[model samples]
Target: MELRTLGYFVAVADAGSVSAAAAVVHVTQPAISRQLRQLETELGLELFTRGPGRLSLTAAGQQFLPHARDVLHRADEARAAARTYAAGRLERLTIAAPTTTLTDVIAPFLATLTDDDPMPTVFESDPREAYPALRHGADLAIVTEAPRSTLAARALASLPVWAYVRDDHPWHGRDAVALHELVDETVLALTPSFRPRQILDTALARLGVPLDRVVDCSNPQVAQALAAAGRGVAVVTDDARFGLWPVQIVGRDGPLRIDLFAAWEPEHHAAETLAALAARLGEFCVERYGPDVAPAGHVGQMGREY
Candidate 1:
């Protein structure tokens, strides 16, 4: 029931063993084991499976893990808030972004911060989790799609999605490839949860193109690597450093593209700071992608046409 016990439980769950959890928490094995037993007794649910040399979560433990993590995260946020208030400085911004955006957008945006400004805390999170993290405590969230909430948001960048191929592949030297042209070829795509993947799927579905033999990758780097190995054509955002031939996806109208947004609550105490950071991020995207990608407007307003 205690916060300390929850922390101990999370450590045990993460480490997968009592002794390992004790090592991480700097507690003796017996103490950790006793605390875990007490926690299970209070909850009236078995959290872990016991074996001679193995420890694993039971169904109940697996179900409880996320809740425990949320509690710990909120506790940490409370402590941070108190400390920042005591120090009489603005609360340090915490920005959460998906892995791809963390590399392409957030990192570059952060490089512009000065010493007088509180250095923002950056964390890599799944795009689906970004908005929720913001609602919970994060100051800023970088997401691919517009958040479902009414949070204030703005388009940060729009990157053209490219089909990458091995140097010797037939499509390597092409300027563009139609979506249907890829229908007959094996495609390496980002995972379903990714915005690019959602866009690609929708486009293909609308065109009645069957995506029967696609390889799903969790990250762009993996997809690019598989394409380099000639496993298939990798679909990703155009990053010249990837060292692959970038072929545009030509639709009937034009090329396919994906937009990234920075979302934040307007009522948050850090609203002004968040807006400033968002503007800087927009500028960073414009510098990298070109002036055409300027932040259009606020999310529900007259901003980016897409």
Candidate 2:
């Protein structure tokens, strides 16, 4: 079966119709329809059931869908491997991470690199999407959530989530604040997609701390600015800004923090090199963040989103 044919099949499955898949794949509807029929002929099973405008996957199709996706993912990894070796060793490095982690953690680590090291191309993704970015094209992915089982992954570090306030604010000199204390004050939080917000939300719910004066911002910098303006206490994993100081958020268990993880496909052509690079990254995170930032031991497991 053609890889293109498989791609079209997956597209059709996602789009719900051959015509709709054609639009996304940028091919004519008749060509897609013909290919789908040929695919069915080769497999000796009907993959879809015809309907008025939409198509539903057949029982066989439903079973085949996951295998098809796996095949496509493997094919993509193969191409990525070929491209990396064909281009030259360490020449095809691309890292994907959440915007805040990309800026705060990865960027700082990259700055410490010498000219001998491979300079990676970086892409900003949501905390959840960071791992999936590897399946798309990224050579390495940094995420707060656990990596998929198929990918080789390692825990980088545990970075503390912070509550930020102006230098003159009453809590600025404090080392840490209780999670329940947030309920009494206006809190500036990032959207749920960010690791800090996820950590905050989970902790608050567990402690039964219902915060009513929470202001949501899409950007951590904005959250810091709002806090500096005395709007609310900024809860984020970002570095302190706007002349603010970071106070560790104390949860019921311990200091509220997010675990950092680096993930990549172990079957990639430069798998060894990628693994080495991820190790170097983990090392740098430890060195830069200081000894207080503990190294995490979780690797290759179905762990929590935080």
Model 1 steric clash pairs: 296-303, 297-303
Worst 10 residues of 2 by lDDT: 297-306
Q: After superposition, how far is residue 257 of candidate 1 from its true place, in Å?
A: 1.3
C-alpha RMSD of each candidate structure in angstroms: 14.2, 14.6
Which regions of candidate 2 are displaced past 4 Å? 1-88, 298-306
TM-score of each: 0.66, 0.68
lDDT of 2 at 76: 97
Top lDDT model = 2
Query: At residue 162, what lDDT does model 2 achieve?
Result: 94
| lDDT values, one for every candidate | 0.81, 0.84
Model 2, 1-306: lDDT tens per residue?
999999999999999987889889999988988999999999999999999988899999999999999999999999987876875467657998888888888888888777777777888887667666777889888878767677777777889999998877788799999998888889999987677888899898888878888888999999999998988899998887889989999988889988888888877767767777777887787787887775745433322112
